[model samples]
Target: MSKPRKPKGRPVSGWLVLDKPFDFGSTEAVSKVKWLYKAQKAGHAGTLDPLASGMLPIALGDATKTVPYVMDGRKIYEFTVAWGEERNTDDLEGEPTQTSDKRPAEEDIRALLPKYTGVIEQVPPQFSAIKIAGERAYDMAREGETVEIPAREVEIHRLTLLKAETDQAHFEVECGKGTYVRSLARDMGRDLGCFGHIAGLRRTLVAPFGEERLVPLEKLVALEEIEDVEERLAALDAFLIPPVEALTSLPHVRISDDQVRRLRAGNPVILRGRDAPLPTPEAYATSISGELVAIGAVEEGEFRPKRVFG
Candidate 1:
């Protein structure tokens, strides 16, 4: 019999909240983080365009299992909309497809906020990651093929205009998953009779992670200068937040050591006591010592393991 190939790199696990710099692609950022950490596996919670800068939560090793939880969380973005021209891609990266000389007044912009604040249908930018007929939309867009992209509902929790200028406007938005800020600028421009595109965009928050947890790429790169390999790895490891941090929005249960062993072995552990939680579709279990053990479901007073952590 042939031997199984072992995975390379350390089995390090945790979340690295990177303050991605402008012009950096999300996939590229993940590669860099994985290489720096020398981890066996790594993945990012959400995709951020090259022109966009901000919080890009990266998961390494076993933490990759919790990425879906973080990606589903609310996001906050601060962006600047440059009026007078609208681009094909809906951002500054694309060629101008439409132009208008009219500038919207501050009152006019404020009046338009209410319309976009609630759940509304939005057409994603043509140059986006959305797939069409099994091909990426951005790839088709780059080939000069314009396809009819359907509009879908996206919830905007809050949209606030912070400043307005003669040719540009700055705003901050808190929105749900899959909401595109680029589309916001494009649609608002068309409504106000002034063409617009995103000139600057920065993500400030992603659910459980906030600006406080963000570590700039440069700061992490600097740790590479440490003389000893072990010390350098330790320094890099210091920035990793616990994997449980990403599951803050989900129901959590602390189990006994015996329960932890059962859960890790892919067995259900009965919940005992009057205060036991009711049935839930999803929840995470931790050891009595507070270490993440497994993500599972609670049903009929039993915690059934779905994804056990190593």
Candidate 2:
């Protein structure tokens, strides 16, 4: 009888969500996973601070192309602010800038939370990745220079005070990309007629992925013992949506073998099968089987593929 053959490890393509471990920098986490998997290429969609732990998506192989879409998704966080205090780093990591002799009441803080809803001005903490003079703002701060990071507009979709105490209040917020929680806490203190700083911060979700899907560092570290690692990967379609077409406006067009060849060759095709108004610039192009094949737009009577995936 022939001996049974052991399964050979194969290359993979997908996104992996790791519940980032506290104290592990985003770069370190990526490196660890890359080394463990012996993957040739890996990258993260968005970076989470070493101090902040939560949903972090790591893209493997061809899935790296979808990272930008994933990173642009809405983000949600649960954090706490220490009223009557301000910090340089805006979080517990920095030295106190100022401390108030009094704390704001819970109701007062709750009332002010709504003020942050919608658009707002946010001056990112000097100790941040923001760039100034071609160097990182945080690096300038570390060199003992007072870096002035200009205020930029960021939107806050929702801000709710989850709980409150005398000196601190818990909060849950849903905000757009680039909105900083540390900056919000700092500003919240100022709103309360006192200084404030972020104390406890946790990112619960980066839309499409939630806390329920996060795998903590402890669990990730133990993954070495587990045989299957595919559970953490996000499907390719998770961030992609098929193009919208109305039956009244246009019907599904089947791409013939010749057209498929043309599409593969990056040729512009006059889709006669397009019975209705083809697709808008935002429409997703897919195969006849409904598999996302490319994103394209109609121009000069030809459908040009903005992005193609065979």
Q: Pick the candidate with the highest TM-score.
A: 1
Q: In model 1, which regions exceed 4 Å deviation?
A: none
Show the colliding residue pairs in model 2.
85-195
Off by over 4 Å in 2: 1-11, 226-261, 269-279, 288-291, 298-302
Q: Per-residue CA lDDT of candidate 1, range 1-310, in tens?
A: 9999899999999999999999999999999999999999999999999999999999999999999999999999999999999999999889999999899999999999999998999999999999999999999999999977899999999999999999999999999999999999999999999889999999999999989999999999999889898999999999999998899887888899988888988999999887677899899999878899999999988999999897
Candidate of highest lDDT: 1
Give per-residue CA lDDT, model 2, range 1-310, as digits (tens). Answer: 9999744433455556777877789999988766665566678878787788787877765556556666777899889888887989998889988888888887787678768999988999888999998999999999999998899999899998888888888999999888899999888888788898888878888766666766666755654664555543222224312222111122233455566667667776676543534555533445576544545566555666655555
Model 2 root mean square deviation, Cα atoms: 7.1
Q: Give the TM-score of candidate 1.
A: 0.99
- The alpha-carbon lDDT assigned to residue 211 of candidate 2 equals 64
Global lDDT of each candidate: 0.95, 0.72
